[model samples]
Target: DAGVTQSPTHLIKTRGQQVTLRCSPKSGHDTVSWYQQALGQGPQFIFQYYEEEERQRGNFPDRFSGHQFPNYSSELNVNALLLGDSALYLCASSLGLAGDSYNEQFFGPGTRLTVL
Candidate 1:
């Protein structure tokens, strides 16, 4: 089966622009997590979704939003983008909620967003 996958591999937007990135989870996975990775830094958790509801969120501001579809696909939407928003957006798939100890995450190749 195919692992997690992200769309538009790369994107460019001006500051204040809005962008949406998509992800499709691996087979049989029901949860999805989004992360942002800046240059030279490890991925930072953005939010997580399970059963089509956002279950957890990290330190990101309100400008960052997301949704999970019934088919286990997800979309990460960022509004009023800023230069600081430029980063590699990652999507990871797992079998259960973040609280589940047995859940192992499989990450996608990531969508690279550049803000000018």
Candidate 2:
């Protein structure tokens, strides 16, 4: 009965450091997607996982990666983080392909990361 959940509500790190954020999907949901939102910009898609495999991705670089566990939980990892990477990382889940308006993705509050 819970909605999507994310860990480490906020984080702070220096340039070049790596960070991993986590998420747990709502009950009965399977697909998980990640997005990055800058201070004043809309979220940019990171990637998505379904059945433990990455099903879709965005324009992000290879440094952005993720994993989905059997329980429908997921993790988002950023390597060699850059100052520009400082933003709110959001996790979303849906029962089916998120494109369908009927099955719109439910989002989490997001993990805020600050890069110095």
Candidate 3:
């Protein structure tokens, strides 16, 4: 069973450019969620996708968007990125919304984005 995986491990970008981050969910999971963690801050939920559709969204601006494909993999996109967007982007996966605690989500190693 494969665990969640993220790309590049690290990334560097300018303030006005765009970036794309990738993720693959854990085995036997059908949902994916993205999070942004600033240094010394807890992760802020960006959004979640299930059944190939976005199910819930957080307070992030329109610049943050994502997509989930049929295979349960996902990609997060940030447009017109800002310096504040520099943070550790984490990808989490969970099973469907069953009473199972398995729905509690497991995180990826994260993609660290540095915006200068």
Candidate 4:
């Protein structure tokens, strides 16, 4: 049984460029959530996907978008990226939307994105 997973463990890009991050949920999980962790700060919620629909989002801007497939995997997209956008993009897998049933969370190591 694999836990959450992320791709392109590391990435480098110039400001104003676009980037896409990928994630696959854990087995038996149907919900996927994304977060951004700055150098020394805690993770900031980006958005969440459930049943192929976006059910929740954080304080991120419109440039940040996401998608969830029927298989429960997800992708995060950042357009017109900024230097500040550089960070560890994390993916978390849960049983369902918050407060649904399961509370335990599974996490991925995260994708490191650097915007120069």
Each candidate structure's TM-score, on Cα atoms with residue i matched to residue i, is 0.96, 0.94, 0.95, 0.95
Better of 1 and 3 by lDDT: 1
lDDT for each residue of candidate 1 in 9-50, tens digit (9 for 90 to 100): 999999999999999999999999999999999999999999
Candidate 2, residue 97: lDDT = 64
What lDDT tens digits, residue by residue, belong to model 4 across residues 13-65?
Answer: 99999999999999999989999999999999999899899898899999999
Rate residue 80 of model 2 by lDDT.
100
* Candidate 4, residue 25: lDDT: 93
Which candidate comes out best when scored by TM-score?
Answer: 1
With a 3 Å backbone cut-off (N, CA, C), the pairs that clash in candidate 2 are none
Cα error, candidate 2, residue 25 (Å) = 0.5
Which portions of model 2 miss their true places by more than 4 Å?
A: 98-102
Candidate 1 vs candidate 2: which has greater TM-score? 1
Question: How close is each model in CA RMSD to the real structure?
Answer: 1.3, 1.7, 1.3, 1.4
Error of 1 at 78 (Å): 0.2
Candidate 4 minimal-lDDT segment of 10 residues: 96-105
Model 4 RMSD in Å is 1.4
Candidate 2 CA-lDDT value = 0.93
Residue runs of model 1 more than 4 Å from their true location after superposition: 98-100
Q: In candidate 1, residue 40 scores what lDDT?
A: 100
